[model samples]
Target chain A: MSEVKSKIKRVSALKQRGKVLRDTNPLLAVFQWGCNHMMNEAELVSDQPLILDRDFKAFSKVQVHNQYYNEQELPNKFKVKEYCPVVFKSLRHRFGEDPADYLTSICDGQIYGGKSTGKGGGDIYYTHDHRLVIKTLAKEEVASFHHTFKQYYSYIVECDGDTLLARYLGMYRITVHEKETYMVVMNSIRPVGIPTHRLYDLKGSKVDRKASDKERAKDLPCLKDIDFEEAQERLYLGGDTETFKETLKRDVQFLEKHNLMDYSLLVAIHDCNEQTPGEIDRDVDVYHVGPHAKDLKADPKRLYFIGIIDVLTVYSTRKRAAHAAKTAKHGARAEISTVKPDQYAKRLLEFVSSMLA
Target chain B: MSEVKSKIKRVSALKQRGKVLRDTNPLLAVFQWGCNHMMNEAELVSDQPLILDRDFKAFSKVQVHNQYYNEQELPNKFKVKEYCPVVFKSLRHRFGEDPADYLTSICDGQIYGGKSTGKGGGDIYYTHDHRLVIKTLAKEEVASFHHTFKQYYSYIVECDGDTLLARYLGMYRITVHEKETYMVVMNSIRPVGIPTHRLYDLKGSKVDRKASDKERAKDLPCLKDIDFEEAQERLYLGGDTETFKETLKRDVQFLEKHNLMDYSLLVAIHDCNEQTPGEIDRDVDVYHVGPHAKDLKADPKRLYFIGIIDVLTVYSTRKRAAHAAKTAKHGARAEISTVKPDQYAKRLLEFVSSMLA
Candidate 1:
């Protein structure tokens, strides 16, 4: 909790005093001084009015504070309900306990990220019931802190060991007497025990055009190490070239981000008399060669590590030329010593994974 | 003409070429880039494309020189027949000669102004054949500058050489292309003998609040020569009470660009009146005003010069305050000085009349 507290910057008391719009009408405040919240969407109008009443400051601040409290506290109420069948079944499969199934829905407590940054936090929502918004409160004392929805959810999922993709369950658009309109969203309960990797295949089908609709309906893309050549071939088959390329690029990134693959080396298990690349078993999950390599082409039991010995090969020459072009654009050193092939492989994999996922 | 040429910069030359795609495809060109020209009233794209060609060097100077010459020499086939009744009537009124009357339609060399620019220039289109579109000869010329239809009519009515208001005739949408998709608008002619001051009443009525069909028809609050008091009042009327004072305060600009009322000195006139305590019709327009002053009273002989004295008084005080503010902002004294009432009054009259004829 202290770590989480340190991560968030507390909203200053000066900002909370409602001093921001003393010279303008609160209703038209957004028009006068443009709203910083999603400011990109609206245009600023000239000749906006001013608010003059000093007495309204305390009342406005209290109203804002209460809204903050209401948002967090009310959202927790829906999580208490045990009626969700999907959540219940997932819990039973994982823990073999029907009575304690709903405990998974209970929040372990939210972790605040650095800021309410666009690239950072998770989006939290309340259930349809107004009671769910009370999750924001702590004994009616509003503690102001900033956090992004992405970071918030990432922290929660990691701590709770759940594989649920956050989904909006409901929303309430409420207007306060003196303040602006606010929308509070409620999210459905997430279940545990399912692997994180599997969730990507399940939810990713919506945007994944590489898989046919019929194939997607039957089975998701299996979470296994993909062959680099086959993936590149699929991309080049090219009915829709851009789409295919993007799909392959994202797939590579996904593998690297999750620490599943590298590019320069291949892990081979040859004791089963596999002669060609196609003979490799479906169960054989190909992993990238690690940085530490000694002997090559030894027995499987002897741990012969993956290695790229043909640096003078045509493929290696092409890779070096591509690297040089990129380096030149970035004003990097022209020397081959600056190139980090392993890191490049890792980044490439992550980029691919993000698109596929 | 040289002075006008000196003021204008030749930004770029555009080639008027269209692309033919499929049979159903609309003609495409560089000018229509980013625009929805397919829509009912669509014209040029919003983020206008670079109109000039990539290699901007003059391709052929002789070609452009010949192009302009050839266009002027070509006879207009759309000219009204010599014996036409409508042409005969217009020519009879214009020249009062039977031989001249035979040439029914004639080109009057004046650029029609008021309706578009809110300033009076020339009414050239009246005597010309209304159906004809006058074009430039160059194939590379852009359409907006290529042709103008003889749409508007203007007539001067006077008794004993004393000029009354130039009366405008009614407008007609002159279609130029197939399907009558495009139009050129002409001036709305008025009865010739109306007094010049009466043009304000006519212009005011043209702003139809009930004409829900036109976007510009919506009532736009025109701020003319509003003194500080009227300015204060209008500010309150426009917005809620909370923002009224603040918005007005921000708008109280000492060094007003006044370009906002480019057609008239009416805004300045209003401002002068409001600054003075008890004066009505501040006579600020009597001071140096420009062409956009149609909505103002400009009769110098009958005008009381008392308001001029008041304005001069206010101007001196405002000048002192303006100097102080500028010195404070820029940490230096500026060159703005207060004008004496008698001197300002004389200068104002000279500037105003210089614009009239």
Candidate 2:
């Protein structure tokens, strides 16, 4: 017994000991762990693969299976497949991010955004810092992203950061308990440190155009069509409306060309007291939006952050049937959440431009 | 919104979800993670390095400084080093264990044995299966292990596991938060799933040879010399005394040769109602003890798990000084848990063999 005591004494005297932290929960902790695991694996992939034409149709998938013994904290196994990994890695760099920092920001930290799974059923996750949004995508959406990934890359390159479309950073397939979850990460509509007083997901539709009572109760409700109409919120491009509208038209034209539909302008409004006209121009990518008008007084302190989101859907024969079916339910004359690609593009442009002040 | 709903509908129809478990805690979980990490790294160590004469005196160290990321679950970093990795890896094989299974059983499952850090100030850990004991070694003890490791390996080879000495498996140096902890793993005295009704750590000295009332309150308290003597127990080696005594003698002589002291015979009595002759031989490692003679008809089923533990101490100059200081306090013939190596070995063998049953 005294010998046991002596051994303990020596252990206490152990030099330069490391700390061990308790996990938040098993699932979240394992997710963080898996991020480390996959990132390490990703390091093995040949760096900067030549961007080939066929790379658009390619997907890099990684599967992990733990057969026996690791059942304590982890189950028998899991699989994580990254879609078009090379493209995404390139996209990461194009967005001015380092892979290591990106992994840390996404996978490390307090993990705050577990907003209730919306009516759509798939979960949406926002990183603690609000710099990233991890949104669940359907298998069809993943296929659609792969379908357009090459052209999408070309468009971003042509215009640099001027496009208004949701910038696709990375996509993944995580299988837990054998259920596959397709997720895509993109930049949040607003800057991380900025405070947003209001936000909206505008589809320019009239029917079912307001936030539900529950959605309205949220701290920053993603309000919709009639809600925006009633609030009379307008896009103020200052005097640079032509340039901003050109980027929007080109972005929408790309979606329309691909027969895509049902995307929206995701908008966040940050109200700051120190609203100098050029404050935003100095801070954000000036190419993203039109410049502030020299004539307008900087009386009300507000800055707008907007980007197009939810553009993965492509109109096919199946969507034609949906268009016909939705027309029957919502009526032919009224604007609905779903429509044909050309009609959706025309209606979105007219509705958005009509809001310019 | 409809598109999002449709995707959700599709996501719901997808199949084969796997479970993600919550971690037990941060530290223990990280230990599990680090095990996976180090084992993967171990794959790179060249196999069967030439066992040089001086190899027994060496160590293999790894220092990890993760400057970015993994700060939540792990510290910004950690270090893990193996003591004579090649020797231990070979030792693992010599003990009839596969490295994979060993790693799985140890690093995968929920860790179970966190023995109270005794007065000696080190914690003892066991795998959930209880087949192995992870004990913390002092800096001095680690040095002493290096001193005697070569001879220990030779002794095990000579006897072919037919002795009472504890089997050494592997040694490690782990640093978390800069603190260094020295650990060594060995075979447990009691086989997994075996029930020991009473156990005693026997040193053969009587200066303080009784279990405290607190110790007696334990389900299987480790009683001492006076307790054993008061109970009036005797050997029941079933007429195999000749073989058992020889093994014991060989083990003690080896200890005496090393000039070590303060070792103890960890004895456990598994009192059962289904004791059948030769049952132990059918189940346990037969070489560990001599078989019971077929004549005995004791009905109560029991299995005694006996082995030597705490054999790391050497009669170095510091130990000699402690011996002199203790001799002055308890008097020259007090047998105060510290004695000359030959005297300690002779006394321990006599006491342990006298109790075999």
Candidate 2 on A234-312: residue-level lDDT in tens? 7675766777678789989999998788788877776666444445553453234321111122214566777888777
For model 1, what is the error of residue A329's alpha carbon versus the real structure, in angstroms, after optimal superposition?
36
Give the residue spans of candidate 2 off by over 4 A. Answer: A1-30, A57-73, A114-120, A273-300, B1-357
Cα lDDT of model 1 by residue, A1-357, tens digit: 000011111111111011112111222222111111111100111111322222111111100111111121121011011111222122223322321111112111121111121111222222112112111211111111111222322332343422211221111112233333322222222111111112111111111213344333533232212322224311112233344345334433333333322122222222323244454332332222211222222233222222221111121343467557757765574322224444544444344344321
How well is each residue in B196-234 modelled by candidate 1, as lDDT tens digits? Answer: 111111111111212123322333322222122223322
Across B165-281, the per-residue lDDT of candidate 2 in tens digits comes to 877777877777667778787777776544567777788877677888987887678788878878875546665666767776887889889987777777677665544445455
Deviation (Å) of A7 in candidate 1: 47
- CAPRI tier of model 2: incorrect
Measured over all alpha carbons after superposition, the RMSD of each candidate to the real structure, in angstroms, is 30.7, 21.2
Q: Distance (Å) between predicted and true CA of B213, model 2?
A: 69
RMSD of 2: 21.2
